[model samples]
Target chain A: MESGQHMLRTGRRGTLFEFSMALRDLVTSYHRRGLAWSLAWHDVVSRYRGSILGPFWITISMGLMVLGIGLLYAKLFGISVAEFMPYVAMGIVFFGLMAGTINEGCDTFVQASSMLSQTSLPMFTFIWRTVLRNLINLAHHAVIIVAVIIFFGLWRVMDVLPALGGLLLTIVNLAWIAMLAAIASARFRDIPQFVMSVMQFAIFMTPVFWKPDAFPDRHAFLTLNPFYHMLTTIRAPLLGQEADGLSYIILAIMAVLGWALTFSVFAITRRRIVHFL
Target chain B: MTDVSIKVTDLTLRFPVYGVDAKSLKKNLARVTVGGRLGASTTGATEVTALSHLNLNLRAGDRLGLIGHNGSGKTTLLRALSGAYEPDEGQIEVRGRIAALLDLSLGIDPSATGVDNIRLRGRIAGMSSKEIEDKMDEIAEFSGLGPFLAMPMKTYSAGMQARLAFAVATAVEADVLLMDEWISVGDADFQKLAHRRLLNLVERAGILVLSSHDAGLLRLYCNKVMRLEGGVASEVKDIRRLDELLAAA
Candidate 1:
């Protein structure tokens, strides 16, 4: 974030100064969109090279899990397959995006240790690099979601449009969480595993497979889970179920407050990342 | 104002040598506020003053060589100039764009072919995609990898890898050029070509700061040299007296 006037400086400062530092990093990263994009693309390409199915392998494995789990969970919950299949598929796919992003975000700067130490690239560029990789994986997973919706004859544009809106909000909120996770993991070294265990437990806790509607008595507490709100924002509308206004409100608060907290952490830790590496 | 310049005043950089326990979240959470304090002590950490009160100044057409024993902060100063590391206390003002060959193999992934490594390294050197694409043939030709450019860099010999690294590092255009160590690569033939190319790059840039252990190399490429020891620096000396400087050491 140093200016080209050839001045590079850092010091003790107020909250506004810290916030501006983080904001400046994002702005600088935005200007160098080409470098981050190429790095992310290279990562995706190199990861799957020589594999026959390439990235679709992620979709295929996810597809099979949805099928097996949908059938069994539907029978267990005593719901019809037609109605339950799309819900399960949507839940798994979108939740996978959220969880995968958080998990990978833990390694964002840690994996870029060389680049951080060697180059003058902006710090947030690595944040976007991790986000882009997850988004790419989501594209592959979208294949399963699209096929399930079409096969189940649940293709109403009206419902799909609002669902996409919620999905966008979900993505916005997750970026802050992922960014915070990246910084924390860089410092602590065990945050990635910690995030891993949290996501593992969070899947069941967040209603990815089980229907939130099934447990009427559980409504009050389920709404307390921020991730449940993250899920229903996208999943509910597509199922012809109304996602309560509270869900959007909660997600909105998360996006605002989470970013505020993340920016402060990022500002404090920005220069020290080289030492951590 | 000079087109290319570097200014440093009372620059300091210090960081802890973290122990395994200090890096653990559980251990940190256990001691709570006590952990960070414990980390500053001998059991958990050793604080390293990588550089202290280091002051330097350079302007356009300055060719400065840095000589130091291992761990004497040669790379640290280069990194600070590259903007990868900020000053801990003082200020470093650098005018104009910088191309830092701090490490030749920094972005050179062995799994990538010679062509792909060119693109990756070019981008890191701050080259735009179009620039890399337009210069692709020239870089490959200069590396002399020829048809072997299609194969993974891992398959190439060490000399070949050095050729590829050198070609990409010197390709970028910048007002300030910072190089760590004189790169010696390939057979005698390739070394001559690489030396000429490096001389051209150094001449084109407004300033150059090179760190090397070879005295003859310093005499050949630099007009002045500085010695560093234990995070401190000796006064800068002229190249004509490099022989005396080395003798004095």
Candidate 2:
């Protein structure tokens, strides 16, 4: 018979234990990758179930926006449409990916409250599902990228390797951001709205439509923006331009720091998360 | 086979009630700007102790029935046992595959069809894809919603939805089963079928914890009865003598 002599107290020690338990749960859930993958696929398929176009709707809209904005904005910025079209196309596609992840991440845990309360599955499973779903959306939007590259004759076989590498790095960074946003939004409840507003503001601020040369004097300030680095790392390679070493360094550092901060907070509050829900 | 057991020692759970305005960032920011004392007075941050210093133990073959009034913490205790709520105080060690039926529609997505929901619910219950696939035909047959299974779940009636949920929940065999109440829905014939299925599932489980207000039902199914009042638990030794026990308490 197991003894119940050891009492479980709700304090700092308990939080530390819960943190370790949460990490274990995360690892175990990863081993059960089928759960996350299927759930993510289910979410995407169900959301657009009855529609004829389904998720291709995203591809169509992105294509139209690229055609319209690429033409109008290229002339406005006095750049050749041939050169500017790919830039804006890649910019919008990648920005949609980044901003969509952040926006959806905020509701990750909150939205799964029903399933979370009923089962003993790991909390990280929901986070992974959110990331996977957004990745699926990104895949749908990538068709537009393919079309733009073909239209603009910007496809380079050699650049494909680096672009994929950059995309993998970006996905790694997104996982941590999603985890952080999900946990925070679950606790605060007001965080999803706050995050959505911030993302809306970030799009204009991050040069998704405008070129960096437009503000030659403020180039230094634009470089400091992490979102700019995030966009450039993947966008540059897809446009057949070399991604600067500085952007890679900045993004790698952000990934490490972001995971560290997210892990610490998640460890302390994993147990209390259910209470908030 | 692993021996199934549950041990809960001095388990306490508290829920913090955040009022409507308290959940808003704008309101909280404004409160912080105003002096701490004034903000504290207006803020409604109170804790409701759902379970208080509750201890329980159950070994294999122990069928424990829980009786409690509204707000008496029966559901809270069930949730804690299912690993849904981490206790604020005390320890809970459960050794078994636990199947918790706290709510019928817990994992059923309204947008999905009945067949799809079975897969989703099975996955949520921690079954591997192979297992879900193996059991799909049986679950479909048990639900008896044959043609309706093709339509979205939102199109199903309440009783039909309940039947699907019950079928999916009881499809897998678990060592420890925690159920909030006896589920009886659908028509007379279907209810009888569901009741028989539930009884078979309860018998096959190593341990069962059920919460319900029907004393007669408890007397029939449970060998041990526990009554919860204000987060405290006490055993009722004899079902026949429950009235005397209640009066004494």
Q: TM-score winner among the candidates?
A: 1
- Across all models, the iRMS values in order are 2.0, 4.8
| Candidate 2 clash pair list | none
What does the lDDT read for residue A141 in candidate 1? Answer: 88
Q: Model 1 segments beyond 4 Å from truth?
A: A1-7, A10-19, B33-45
Residue A89 of model 1 has an lDDT of: 93
TM-score of each: 0.94, 0.93
lDDT of each: 0.82, 0.80
Model 2 per-residue lDDT tens digits across residues A1-277: 2111111223235556767776776886787677898899999989998899998998888889999999998888888998888888889999898888888998888889977765667788888898899999988998888888887787753287777777877888888898899987876778888888988989899978988866763377777887888888788877777777888887888899988888888887787777667
Tens-place lDDT digits, model 2, residues B1-249: 246788888788887776666677777677778757554456445789988888888877778888878889999888888877777778788877788888888877898999899999888877788888999889899889999999999999988988888788777667777888755457877778876875675566467788887776677667777888988888645466666545655
Worst 10 residues of 1 chain B by lDDT: B35-44
RMSD of each: 2.4, 3.2
Model 1 chain A: ten consecutive residues of lowest lDDT: A3-12
The lDDT of model 1 is: 0.82
Error of 1 at B65 (Å): 0.9
DockQ of 1: 0.60
